[model samples]
Target chain A: MRVSLRQAFAYKLDFIFTLILGLLVSLVMIFVWYAVYANSGVSSIGGLSLNAMYVYFFMVNALSFITYNAAVAQTMQEDVQTGAVSTAMARPIGYNTNLFLNSLSVAIVGGLTVTLPMLLIAIVLSHTAVSPAALGLLLIEVLLSFAITTCIGYVIGTLSIYFVNIWGIINLTGFVYYFLGGSLAPLSLFPKWLANILMLLPSQLMMYTPAATLLGIIPMDEIIREIAVGAVWLAALVLFTLLWLRRISRRVVAVGG
Target chain B: MGLKREIKFFITCQRYNWLSFLAYRMQAFVWLSLNALFILYGILTVTIIYGVSSGISGWSYYQMLFLIGTTGITVNAVWYLCNPNGLVRQLRSGKLDSTFLRPYSRLNIMLSASGNVDNSTTAISSLIMMAYAASKIGVDAAGMLLYAALMAAGISAFVLFVMALSVLAYLLIRGANFVNGVLNFMSSSSKYPLSIFGFAGQLIFTLLLPIGIASYYPAEFVLGRLSLSSAALVFVLALLVGAASYVLFHKFMKGYVGGGG
Candidate 1:
C-alpha cells in the first residue's frame, strides 16, 4: 500500500491532465444543461433546477473519477503479455492481493487529490440542501462503487490470459460504464421505460445513486436501497472473481509447466 | 505532379494501415463494434435531450444531428490522418529523424506514417448521419455543395492545427495540453448552436479554436439560418486557420534538431 501510494503520488503530471479532462467534461455539461434550461424556459427539468443539474454533473464527474481504475485490467494485460504473471504467482506474496492494494491506493490518492476537492467546490457552488446523513451515506456508496468497479477490472484483466489483446474490449467497457452508470446523464432524463430498466442495472449504483443522493433529488428509501443493492453486487462480484481466478490459475500453471 | 505523388503516397499509407488492422481481426472487429455503439449512443443522447425539452432555441432535432455529424466527421477525419498521439510517440522515440530521411516533404511523411484507419469508419458513420439529417431538412443542391466545401476546409484546418499541437506538446507539455483541453471544450460547444453560448463563446470558438467554421456555420448555412456571405466568410476563416497552423508548425519545426537514427 505504501509503495503503491508513492507510485501514484509520483505521477503528478498525469493527475493534472486527468483533473483537466474531468473539469472540461463537467464544464461542457454545465453549458449544455444550462442552455437546455434557458431555451426551454423551465424552472426545472427532470426535477432538477439549473443549479441542481450543475451539482449533479459535478458529483457525477467526481464519482466517476474516483471509481475509475481500469489500470488493473490494463496492467494485467501487459503482465500476461510479457509472461510476468507466472513470476508473480511464484512469489510469497499473493498476486491478486498486491493488485488489490495497488487499486485501492490509486482510488485513495485520486479521491484525495482530485475528486474530493471537486466535490467540495461543487457543493459550495450549489445551493442544494445536503444533509449530513445523506452525505455520509453517499461517501459509503462511493467506496462500494469503487470496489465493484475494481472487481470488474479484475475480471476483465483475467481475460488477458486468454486473449492476445483486450485493449478494445477495455475501451468498450469504459464507454458502457460511462453511459449506463449515469455519468453522462441523470436517470431522470431517460425515458420512463428506459429509466426503469436502468434503475435495475448495477451500473446505476456506480455514479447515479450517490450523485442523486447528495443533490437530494432521490429519496432516503432509494439511498438505502442503493446501499443494499451495492452490497449484494460487491459480494457477487467477489465470489465470481475468486472462482474465475481459480479456474484460470490452472490454465497458467499448465502453460507454464 | 508533386500533388499526384503525395496523393498516391497517402493512399498507399492508408492501404498499409488497413492491412495492419486486418492482421488483428479481433481488434478490428471490437473497434468497429465500438464505433457502431458510439453512433447508437450519440443518437440516443441527442434524442433524449430533445425529448425532455424544446432543446437549444431556434434549432430543430435534425439540425443538431447535422451539427453533431459534421463535428464528428471533421475531428475524426483530421485525427485519423494526422494524429497528435502519433506525433507524441514519434517525438519521444526520436523517430522524427527517420521521417526526415524520406524523400517526401515532412508534413506528408508525418501524416502518412501516423494515419489511422479506425476513424475512417467513424467518419463514414457520421457521413451517414449527416446525409440523413440533410434529407430530413431538405438542404438544396447548392447548400449541399457549400457544406461539402466548408467541411473540406474545416478538416484541413483541424489537421494542421493538430500538427501544431503535437509540436507545441513536444516543446511544452502542459501548456499545449491546456490548449487541447480548451479545444475539447470548444468542440463540445460546437455540437450545439454557438448562439446559445452567447457572443463571447462565439468569438472564442471562431477566433481561438476555429471549431465553428467546421461544423456549426456549415450546418446553419444548410438550414438557411445563416447567410451565404457568413458561410463564405467561414470558409475563408477555415482556410486562414489552416494556413496559420501550417506556418506555426513549420516555425516550430525549424527549431527541432533531431539526430539521425
Candidate 2:
C-alpha cells in the first residue's frame, strides 16, 4: 500500500492527468446520455430518468474502470515474465496476500482521487439522496466486486504464465465489462434475452447491479440477493485462486529445481 | 522528384510491413479478432440505442451501421498506421531512431514503413459490413462515390490528427498511456450522429479533432442530413489540420533524446 501510494504520488503530473481524464470521460458520458434523452423524446428509457441515467453512467465509469484495478493482471503478467514471481513468492507475507493487497491499494488510491469526486458529482447531478445504510451496502458491494475482479485479474495473470501472452484475453475481458457490464449502456436498455443472460452471469456485478441497487433501479430484496451472490463469487474465486496458485507454484518450483 | 521518390519508397517498405504480418500468422489472428470485436461492438451499441429509441436524429439503424462500418475502416486504419500503442513503444524504446537511419524521408518512414498490417483484415471485413449496411439503405452509386471521396478525405485528415496527438502524448508521459484510450473513445463516438453533440460540440470535433470528417460527415451527407456550412468548414479545417500535423509531428520528433532503450 505504501509503495503503491508513493509511486502514484511520485508521478504527480500523471496522477493529476489521470484524475482530469477520468472526470472528463464521466462528463462526456453525462453529455452523451443527456443528448440521448433529449433526442429520443422520452422522459425515461429503461425506466431511468435523465438524472438517474446520468448517475448510472457516472457510477458505472467510476466503478468499472477507475476503482477496478486492471493493473493487477498487468503486474502479475510482469512478475511472471520477469521471473519476479520467484522472489515475490519467497516473501513471508505470501504472494496471493500481496497481490490482493496491492490490487486494493491501487483501487483505494484511485477511489480517493477519482471515484469520490465522481460519486459526489453524480449525487449532485442526480439529486438522489444517499442514505447511510445504502452507503454501507454500496461499500460492501464495492469491496466484494474488487475481490472478484482482482481474482479474475489474477486468473488472467496466471493464465498469462501458461499462454505466454494473453493481451487478447485481457482485452476480451474488458470488452465483456464494457458491453455486458453496462459501461456503454445500462443492461436494462439491452434486449430482454441479452440482459437476462447477463444477469445470470457475473457481468451485472461488474457495474449494473451495484450502481442500480444504490440508485434504486433494483428493488431492496434484489439488492440483498445480489450482495449474497457477490459474496459467493468472492469465496469461489478465492478458493480457485488458492488451488490454482498452489498447482502453478509447485510446477514452477519443479521447473526451477 | 524527391517527393515522388519518398512516396515510392514508402509503398515499398509498406509491402514489408504486410509480409511481416504473413510471417507471424498467429499474431495476425489476435489483432484480427480484436479489431473484428471492436467493429462489432460499435455496431452492437447502435443496435442497442435504436432498440431503446429511434436513436440519433435523422439517422436510421442501417445508416448508423454504415457510418460505424466506415469508421472500422478509417479509425482502424489510422490505428494500423500510427497505432498509438506501437508509437508509444517506438518512442519509449528509442526505436524511432531506426526510422532515421532509413533512406526514405522521415515522414514516409513514420507513416507507412512503421505501421502494422493487421488492420487490413479489418478493412476487408468492414468493407463487407459496409456493403451490407448500404444494401439495407439502398445508397445510390452517386452517394457511394461521394461517400468514398469523403472517406478518403477523412482518412487523410484523421491520420495526421492521430500522429500529432501521439507526439503530444509522448510529451505528456503520464497522460501518454491514454492516447489510444482517447482515440478509442473518438472511434466509438464517431458511430453516432455528430449533430447530437450540438453546434459547439460539432465545432470541437470537426476543427480541433476532425473526427467528424472521418465517418460522420460522409454518413450524414449520404443520408442528406449534412449541414453544408459545417461540412464545408470541416473540409477546410481538415486540410489545415493535416498540414499542421505534418509540421507538428516533425517538430515534436526533436523531443526524442534517445535513451528510452
Candidate 3:
C-alpha cells in the first residue's frame, strides 16, 4: 500500500492535469446553474433554495473528485484482456488483494488531488457557509460514498471478464448516474415518481447523499439512514464481486496470451 | 462506373453492420430505447423550464426541442459514422499506412471507414420533431434549408477540429480518449440555447469549441434572430475552420510515428 501510494504520487503530472480538468468542468457547470438560478430569481425549486441548490452542486463537484474508480476498473480490464492477469495471479499475493490495495492508493491520491484544489477555490469563490459540524458530517458521508463507489468499480472490473466491451457499459452507466443521481440537477426537478425510483438505485448514494448532507438539506437522522443504506449497498456489492470473480474465473478459457 | 463502385462498397459495409446488429437485435433495440429516453429527458427538462418562463431566449418550447433534437442528430451522426473509423486508433495500429498506399484519396477512405446505419434512428426522430416544431413556428422551406446547411457545416467543422486535436494528442499521449470524453461533455451542453449562458460562456462555445454554430446559430437563423448576412458569415467561418483543421491534420500526419511494432 505504501509503495503504491508513493507510485501514485510519482505520477504527479497525470494527477495535476486531471485535477485541472475536473476544476474547469466543475466551475463551468456552476456558472451554468448560476445562470439558471439568476433567471429564476428564487431560492426554491420544489422547495430547495438558491443557496441549497448551490451547496448541492458544490458538494456534487467536490465528491466527484473522490468517487471515480473507473480508472482502476479499466486497468484491471486491460490486464485481464491482455493476459497480464495471469502474471499477477502467479505473484505471492492474491490478485484481488493486489488490485484493492492499488485502487485504494490511487483513490487516495485522486481524492486529495481533487479535494485540496477544490477546497481552495471553494473558499475563494463560493459564498455558502459550512459549519464545523456540517463539515465533519460531510467528510464522513464523502468517505462512505467513496468506499461505495470503489466497490462499484470492482464489480464493474470483475464483470469486464465476461463482457469484453466494458467501455460502452461504463459510459452508459456513468451518464445515467450523472443525470439520475441528481448530480446535474436536483432530484426535485425530476418527476416525483422517477426521482423516487432513482433514489433506490446505488447512484444516489454516490452524489445525491453527499451533496444533500453537505447542503444541510438532509437531517442528521436522515444522514444516518443514508449512511446505513450506503453501507448495506457496499456489503452487497462486495459479495457480488466475490461471486462474480469466482464464476468468471472458473469459466475463463484462455484465448490468446 | 465510379459511382457504381462507391455504391457497391457502401452497400457492402451497410450489409455487414446490418447482419452484426441483427444478431443482437434486442441489444440494439434496448440501446435505441435508451437514446430515446435521454432525448425525452431533455425535452422534459425544457418543458419544466418553459412552464415557469414563457420561453428561453425568446424561443418557444417546441422550437427549443427542435434545436436540441437537431443537435443530437448531428452529433450522433458524426460519432457513429466518422469517429469510430477516423480516430487515432487506425493511425496507431498502422492501418492508415495501407490507406496511404491506396490509389483512392485519403479523405475518401477516412470518411468511408465507418458506416453508422444505427444513427439513422436519431436522424429520423430529429427530422420528425424538427418538422413539427418548424410548422408550429411558421418556418418556411428556405429557412429550413439554411438551417440544414448550417448544421451540416457545423458538424463537418466539429469533426475536423476534433480530428486535429486528436493528432495533437499523438505528440503528447498515445490515446486521445480523455480528449474525446471532454468533447462529448462539452457537446452535450449544445442541446440548450447558447444565449442562455453568459457572454463569456457564449464566446467559449463560439470561438473556442465551435459548438455554437452546431445548434445555436442555426436555430437562431431559423428563429430570425440572426440576419441572412450573419448566417452566411457563420457558414463561411465553418468552412474555413473545417478546411484549416483538415490541412493541419495532413501536416501532423507527416510526422506521426506509428505506435507499437
Residue-wise lDDT of candidate 1 within A2-47, one digit each (tens)? 7656775443564477467768768777888888898899999888
Clashing pairs in 2: none
Give the residue spans of candidate 3 off by over 4 A. Answer: A1-21, A43-55, A71-76, A150-163, A239-249, B1-41, B44-57, B81-86, B89-95, B109-142, B172-178, B257-261
Model 1 chain B lDDT-worst window of ten: B174-183
Q: What's the best-to-worst order under TM-score? A: 1, 2, 3
Q: Candidate 1 or 3, higher lDDT?
A: 1
Screening candidate 3 with a backbone cut-off below 3 angstroms (N, C-alpha, C), the clashing residue pairs are A43-A49, A43-A50
Q: After superposition, how far is residue A138 of candidate 3 from its true place, in Å?
A: 3.0
List model 2 lDDT by residue over A209-246, tens digit each: 87887798878787787778878878988899878877
Give the higher-TM-score candidate: 1 or 2. 1
Give the native contact fraction of candidate 1.
0.44
Give the TM-score of chain A, superposed on the true chain A, for all candidates in the order listed: 0.92, 0.90, 0.83
Model 3, A112-225: lDDT tens digits are: 656655654564565656678877876776676667666667777765576654654555566676776666676656667887777666677767876776566768887777
| Top model number, TM-score | 1
lDDT by residue (tens digit), candidate 1, B72-157: 78767875886565565676567778768867778887888776678777788888998998899888998899888988898788
Better of 1 and 3 by TM-score: 1
Per-candidate TM-scores read: 0.93, 0.89, 0.81
Quote the positional error of residue A81 for candidate 1 in Å: 2.0
* CAPRI grade, predicted model 1: medium
